[model samples]
Target chain A: MSSLIVASIYQQVINDVIHNIQRDFEDSGVDVSVLNELQQLWETKIIQSRVTNFPPEDDKNQLEQEEDMENSSKRGTNKQKAKARSKSYNQNLSVGNINQDESEDELSDANSVVSNKYPENETKFTGQSAASLASIINTSNTNNMSANTGYPLSPSQRKNNAFEEDYDDQNSSTDDESQNQPLSTRAPQFLASGVNAPLASMSPMMGQRNLDQAQQNSSKINDLLNNNATGNDYMYQSLGSNSLANNNSQDTKKPYLPQNDGCDDPISVWKIFLAERKLKQLNSANKLDSTEQNKDFNMTISQVDGDNSENGGDITEHMVLCQYDKVSRTKNKWKCVLKDGIMLVNGRNYLFHKANGDFEW
Target chain B: MSQYYELYRTSTLGFALTDSLDELIQAGHITPQLAIRVLMQYDKSIAEALTNHVKARATIKGSLKTYRFCDDVWTFIISNPNFKFENEVVSADKVKIVACNARRPDEA
Candidate 1:
């Protein structure tokens, strides 16, 4: 009785899907025979899995007819009727699967077009910055030369020119320094440049021979330089601490080395370090190889486990898919009202309209 | 639009249909999009057929090992479960129950 019900439920599902997707198949320009083939393949697979005993072929036709009547009775809703009409109209002008590929290609082309704009915009932005920097430098140089030759420039004007030159120097030095340090180390340099900008402007005031102001500015510059030095020291300290941790680990492992044989010679110590590094590399490589082999072994085991049952595995096999009408629990006892469920138990499939489950946790 | 849950796709029947659809796709007899539409139809049809056609009722008793309620889905792992139908009783060492809410998402 259970097998028969399951078989009939499966039959109904397959028939309903096939009937519903006829328009989709037509629109896709796939031959109707392919859909028939899919149906046959699906049925054969289900039978092979032996989830349930299907009725004889003659009985199948009777079951299908009965299901068809039931479906027809329930499928008279206006929404589906409207959908059917629309599908019929679309069938006349359906462009088929070829158009689908073309549409995908067009979508990719659009994405590529959008992606191509990004690099061009980045280049334009960089070019504008470079041009503006060059202009600033040129104007400052011309103004300084004109002031020196024609007349004495005001302190503020000299200060502005000095600040510009300092900024240009910082920019060029930073570009060069960037090549030697990681990006994280550049943060302190930017802070240093920001602190130096105002002090750099004051340097020209010292050149004007205001003795007291010159001394004050020099002291301020010294303090700023000290602060900049501390910032750099902190950055370097973080990097050094990381390296120190690594060295400590290496030192702990160093006892394994032959300490009695030429341990005092610098060359011997360097050679030992090189050999240890090579051994570590080889060990890591071997570990990676073993991990890969383990992965392959696991894959084979899982594949064998999957082959043990055609229904994927025990997890998928002994499972239930259902809707819960009501689920309530009190203390350790649990109860549920499950409806419209498909239960795969002990390699056999069962269909139930409603299931009452009482369990203790 | 009424949408059906894809929870049943892990069932043997749905798995077989998906395997066959995959084969059709691999053979270039049908596109992936068409296969997806077929699956969508399958979801709707199966949900409807199970609700309207089958009338079998079952009573199950077990010791629940683990129970979880997440995202409106109730999952229960039961040990030594016994399922009793009209005249037949099926027993399994362990069974997993994955139950979605009866009320549709849109309805909720």
Candidate 2:
């Protein structure tokens, strides 16, 4: 009776942990597709470890019985659905050995739980992918079984041994009564079992690390989708589809263009203000054609450039230095001014894009 | 104060959100989980606002409550999408390497 209670509790805890992990991934912006991959990876690890760790035939038989009963009941509705399918479809769906219905059913149970949890946006595992994943899991499990039965442990299996040690430490410290019981009385040890005890305490750290990795992977995928966007260039790619679409149409309407004249030379604020004023005036006049306005705009920018060339260089330099000093003083920091009209950020000079207020370096 | 706190103070929106959080913390309603969620929400809002060209003050309604923040300077702040609230100031080359989805000059 005590053993049955312990087993039930363990199963409940596993379900809770799986649910929590799903929630954690969802909150971290991991979509259904990636979540599916993560779940598969975790389940694979659990199965592989179980194959190696559980040696006694009695324990294996009991576990298989429990898993079979649970999976069949869960898949009870699906069995009828499967009956209507053609033999070829059933063969395709049954990726594992036909005799090992219990394990296959257990695998499907895990997959179905994830799908059922997110009915609205779940990414279901297709037959082909599920088959391939099952095959991979089987091969890994066989390797683990061989390592346990015949040869010394592989490096990864050694890690699993370490995990078992940690699990023993945790289990012994927490449940002294359970420690006295025979190992065969316990439930089949899976990868998640060892990790679950530490999960509550370590979840924040683990979740954060996993979230960071997932975010990086997704960002890389996004970049690849965007024609291998190079260096601050992906920003423009994503922004172009939305807010910039309007700007693009406006650009087509107006023949006026902003040109990058020199890398070092900074456009005076006054020049931009003057240009804005002239453009506004020309827009209001409604008499000048686009080509004409474009000509006027270019002439105005060049004329401002020419006029500034006389004293604009020195004055702008002085103004930038003063602004830099003001910022530095406010922040209680000292920074060296550089040759280019760059803004000092964290005590370093970086070229500033006045139009969008970005670093141009 | 973290670098993000400093950066937030530079704008009205950042100030408003920070102030609101301060008020919540003082009120004893803010947990660590809540704080992290709020921070993530703030970052997402900034990114979304930048993409949508919301160049004015906007109100964001989170799961907890609604708060208003200035977005006028978001275009400048969002020049790098790789920025997170937890990130420190990186070098210019690293910044340049961050793919910017900012509107092109033609589009702008």
Candidate 3:
């Protein structure tokens, strides 16, 4: 059986971190609710990952009840607050469970409803001054969901709309309509307005040459966009070919190479950064493919070789985190005393207070 | 403030916490600065917890595939290792050992 100590170890770590950071939270002037949300999110993530088995819910509740009973007199208010938090958390989980079979859109909608109701739940728990806390709690809940679901695009788009409204009051009516349009259609207008704002602020004495340059830059941007569209489609095909072909294509697609000469110009600098980022992404993707192929080839070779020598193959995934009491080596042999270690083997995690290791290099 | 090694952040538990923190940051729930503070707290907490709370003992034997000592840290790659726990023996084809100095840098 796997070691049962991991659950308590993790629990103790969470408690320690929360306890230690309480003062820091207060010092930073962030609401306590965010801290509680952090703890809740951490626990939910750990439980979801299933890296190690935790006790069943009934047993866990029993343990918490026992602890509550023992400390009820000293920390009664804290216990009550914890109870409220857990109750709300359970409701959130139940909502998710009930909507699990629904479409993703419906599930997200249900989550939003629960998020809206969260402030009322907090109000009931806190009694006074909850009206002020309601908005923060609501945003926290929505943001928490966005984090959990791994789809932050919608929230960011909403933020961009809010930003646009704040900056462009005259265009607010058009902004409301644009918000309903697809991002591709909306983005160009946003960029155009952004460009026009600075130009309008500049004095005419800045010269027609500057205006002409701006027009030239806009044309160059259009060319870059067209290049990007074709480059992306080619990238999809390049994944099947070798890295050399990808590099050759990257070299040939240098229409904007002249801009790199103007290193002092901010626009050119930004363009260089963007180009480098795209190149890095492409190179990293190719590296991932090669590494994956190497891994597969190594696995096949290992299988064929069949345990011929102890040190014949690459290191597998097993790992140990510990402190050494002493490490002594003689010739090619090695010995060490490892203390307070967590060992991960196969898929299970084990904790050891002391470990004696004997090995030959 | 005592300094602790951030190496354990690569472990499974630390990786889980880091992933959670990343999600929170991406959602704009917490700032990257706050996440760094939380991770620092985690490093101290787990190190202390492991030292003071853990009580199990084990013995392992293997052939050391590679060993390196640098900047007061030990990295050992052991092949075909067998771990003898209290009740059972577990074996792995290979295991990497990351051992930080038992003494804190401040103390040293």
Candidate 4:
């Protein structure tokens, strides 16, 4: 007996990442071709994750995603692309910059090009080079992103998990009584059958401490001290093209974990979503506190207006915060996304929305 | 009041297109049905006049309607890209971030 499986990343994404690698290694066309091919091979693994419906280990996906985005966003525009892409941009600047070493062609000139533009002492995050898209699709994780309650995953996490093809038969055929029952009555939805309720009316928000949010606040402070970026780095990777190799010899052991049994647990999903929300609140308060410490940082983080790169400007958006309302599109479900964020008039940063997802100009 | 307008006059950032000559004439920036191209080519003084109006402010209240654009290009300024109406602090006392992307009826 024998079996087979294959994974994929969009050909466009591979092409996009490889294209940047090509530019970075322009002087060494052979190595550029080799690395481009390597990135393509890696992308096949990503497509596999999507098929398996499990996330990849976070860090690798994050890095590939970041690099892929930086390359893509600056693409098409010839003169207006990032100056920092050239080896010369970082040549004069800070020490121990990881991007410097990867930029191999001009290592000798690096000694003289120290830059004061990017403040020294910046702390940076590194993620795994992702081979699969599913690994990077978690509701809260992004390479350049700080958890924003503002913009949301369009086909959100719950929807992705709940609608997996395998679960359709089992879930759709629930007894009529259960189908018609109001959502609140069931306390054990996503909980696997035989898993008992922890407690009714239990305050899920009360017990756990959000250590990650606290840490993110401190890291942001570290980022300001080290570099000028106050969180304008948020982006999604662009799609590129490449050819993947044979996966017949690849290892495909799945990490042991609970599968979605779907007995029905709204609290679990809601709590997971709110984990980032709580983090956002903490980060906002902490940002306010830090703004008192440094106005420059606040301005840097929140200055998201009127700079269209199409206008031949070098400015990057520092931040453009949005908050979408909860809108019901399906049974007892709402899409929480940022385009839903109502905008304010009078050039004011305010919006008024109701519980029913209505908005007034 | 004149001084306030001076402070907030029609700088490059405050440039916008008006849909009607009636509105422009009503605001006294132009006469009825006059060609916009003629008005645009001739209105270097409007900014100067508006600046004089802006400098008269005692407090930052009652804003006049004007189009603030990223550039002088019409499409770049008016294309409804999402904007965050971030309120910056002149003094560090009142700073906040909010989503703001609407034009008042007059400006629209």
Candidate 5:
């Protein structure tokens, strides 16, 4: 029976380990399957433990006791807060239970880690802000639906969603594993700190050329109306095809990249990729200059990271929304990668990068 | 105790990585350091006597696809027909992560 108990013990450990690995690698590409065989061993142990009713360890209660002791100091008003957080967390976990294997209690404990009601005021992995982590972690099914979100979701909807997620991330339960290093944050927020670093100093007019081209070629409204009357359907179709083909070619250039190890470290790999991208941007800009085209507004470095504030460092009291040079200004769409290679998106700027806004419109 | 190594030793039993375990650990069901340590040791990057940890970006989901490179961080696509990845620094986030399939038949 001791062998059975040992089997159960190892299985439990492996199962839990794989579960965490999945969470780490879920949305990102850190293929954690390198450790998957261990999961079967764990599942077996769990089944054995259940059939035999073997109790391997009770250390969980000891930790809970310590947690209670820690929270005892603020027992007066935090009871409600704790209850609400734990309750919602439990609900989320129960929902997860429909798809997972953990016991209800175990899953609830885990959900609290990503729920809006934990004590994640102290972050682990990397000491990023609650607001950022809230968006990054526990967002498994976020894009399961198409981003073309049937009806436009208002900015308030986005903010409210972001706010709830931030709450969960900030107050997430502080597990031992989470207490390690902080998550990766791309490039130290190269622009947010207002460092004036060259890596973050590309001009924003970099993107305007394409917009200007689109607008310039957008045949006058009267001409378009006349063309609509005279032109054949084939012409419009061919134009549409040409536009899509151009965009596809730009997207498919397959810029050079260093082989990346895992899926979860977008920030790290992106920074490394961007380092090479800087040279390409310079080359492209030079070519444009030679042709005497797009010289007016054609440089922009808009990096983003955990350190970024609303806009570099110069926030205006009377708000002037810095408009982005969009590939297409159609609403509810976000295309950071444009026909002119990758470009900036409005919302957040990193380090001290600013958009040198020059519009031909 | 050394989960990855033990599996490596067998090298016979079919192995498929599960995403549920990653969720559990992120949610605090298990320890990340210890778990990753055990996983890495199985990757043969660790010595039995060495208990210390070495960090590297493991797997990532990017805008286009969800993929994980080998230990050297070499490129390997995890789609329908698993193939060696060409060199490039690809981001890991902003992609939809699907569950990994079974390991190659010749891995043993």
Candidate 6:
């Protein structure tokens, strides 16, 4: 019986660990199967402990106590705030119940780390901020849909339908002669509400470049357009769409954080890879005199002469990002191998020491 | 407890290292001090550790170390499939060290 309990506890731990790993490595190239290997190791440890007539110690009770303590404090404050908000919005107890169910799901998903509403506030993790944690924690599917979807959702969906009417109202308010008119059909209303604009229709690469450039040029306009587009009503009412709506509401939440880990913005890595290739070509061809080619690469190259006095002094500048290539010959290759690489996080550069083959900062 | 040595350090577990160490300690696999020592010696950077602990950055006495040798005194061992790392614990009071050997499996 003790072994069974132990197994269940270990399984829960493993499941929680895998979920966290999935959340952290969502869009990265990091092989998450390493966690599986670690899981197997734990299983072996459990088996070894069992065979030796010594079961793995159970800390489930203790963990539960710590979690309960953590939850009560957070729950108290959240209840007060939730009560005040519901009263001001003239919302009923159903909304409060739905929000409670969502936060509980978030707590379990984050391994009882206790995620609060205000993401920018200081998080409960050691000393990190809530935004830093929220960026990585997947909080979209935490709603207990089965319990609250049928009854409590009608009011919210009505609100959303009302919101759609507003979009229609605005569309009709526009110049009557304009070709961009709101379609009478409900499904087409979503597509016509400026949600699927010309920019979204462009190829992903062009769209991304245009979006980046647009953001750099006029961030306010970009944000306004995004807000206007996503605020429209949805035609479908599936769980997936509901979660997507939640994600849209949390605009500040990024799918990933800019940690020193090599899995940064894939676009940034691609840009660096292209820039490095161009730099290598220029270096090999003795074309350092011209700054024109550098402009073609679209990367800033700052060259500092090592020493003026030394005849054979080599020019030295730190590579903005270093990704290790197992095949040394391929180190100059354009593809990024970020598995073992130098990552700069929070201003401290965690470098892959070429000499020791270990990450050092 | 003294006879069994830790084959893996806390840092080797990657991003989940901290939580894994805590679990291992709670499970009685290893003491908390051992985990702390492993973390302390993993990279040994005051600034990086502090920044990792807190989201804020600070300047410390020793920054990250870098090697840009002009001479051939130190040869850069390129990452090869044969680069095998063996971590072993010899005796109690002695530390577990990682020894890397660059040899292919088919090599005589």
Best by TM-score: 3
For model 5, the superposed segments whose C-alpha errors exceed 4 Å read A3-52, A55-59, A63-361, B1-17, B20-108
Misplaced by over 4 Å in model 2 are: A1-13, A28-44, A50-361, B1-108
Instruction: Kindly report which residue pairs in candidate 2 clash with one another.
Output: A232-B99, A232-B100, A235-B100, A235-B101, A235-B102, A236-B100, A236-B101, B13-B70
Instruction: Give lDDT tens digits, candidate 2, residues A1-361.
Output: 1111222222332333334445544453333322232222222222322222123234434543454466545443322222222132333322111111221222233333322211111011111112222223333232112111110001111222212322333222212432343231112112223322222232223212212322322331221111111101111222233322122212222221222233221112212222232333233233223353453344345344553212121111101111110101123222222111112223222222121111221
Candidate 1 CAPRI category:
acceptable
Candidate 4 on B9-79: residue-level lDDT in tens?
A: 11111111111111111111111112222223223233222222212111111111112223222111111
Sort by TM-score, best first: 3, 1, 5, 6, 4, 2
What local distance difference test score does each model get?
A: 0.48, 0.24, 0.47, 0.22, 0.24, 0.25
**Candidate 5 residue-wise lDDT at A345:** 11
Off by over 4 Å in 6: A1-361, B1-108
Measured by DockQ, the strongest candidate is 3
Error of 3 at B54 (Å): 0.6
Which of 1 and 2 is the better model by DockQ? 1
List, residue by residue over B1-108, the lDDT tens digit for candidate 5: 322222221111111112222322322222333344435533332112111221111112222211222221111111121111122122221111111111222343
Instruction: List DockQ, one per candidate, in order.
Output: 0.25, 0.04, 0.37, 0.04, 0.01, 0.05
Output DockQ, candidate 4: 0.04
| lDDT value, candidate 1, whole model | 0.48
Model 3 per-residue lDDT tens digits across residues A292-314: 34644554465455442122233
How far residue A267's Cα lies from its native spot in candidate 5, in Å, is 16
- The parts of candidate 3 lying over 4 Å away from their true place are A53-315
- DockQ order of candidates, top first: 3, 1, 6, 2, 4, 5
Output the number of the lDDT-best candidate.
1
Over A1-361, each residue of candidate 6 has an lDDT whose tens digit, in order, gives: 2212323333344445544444333332222332332333333233322321122323332433343364445433333342333244333222212222222222222221112222221111101111122123313311211111111112111122222222323223212311232221122212222322232222123223223332321432232222211111111111123322123233223221112223233323322332333333234223324353442222222212312101111111111122222312233332112222222222112222221233222
Estimate the Cα RMSD of every predicted model relative to the unseen true structure: 29.7, 26.6, 17.7, 26.2, 26.5, 21.9
Q: Which residue window of length 10 is worst by lDDT in model 6 chain B?
A: B88-97
Docking band of candidate 6: incorrect
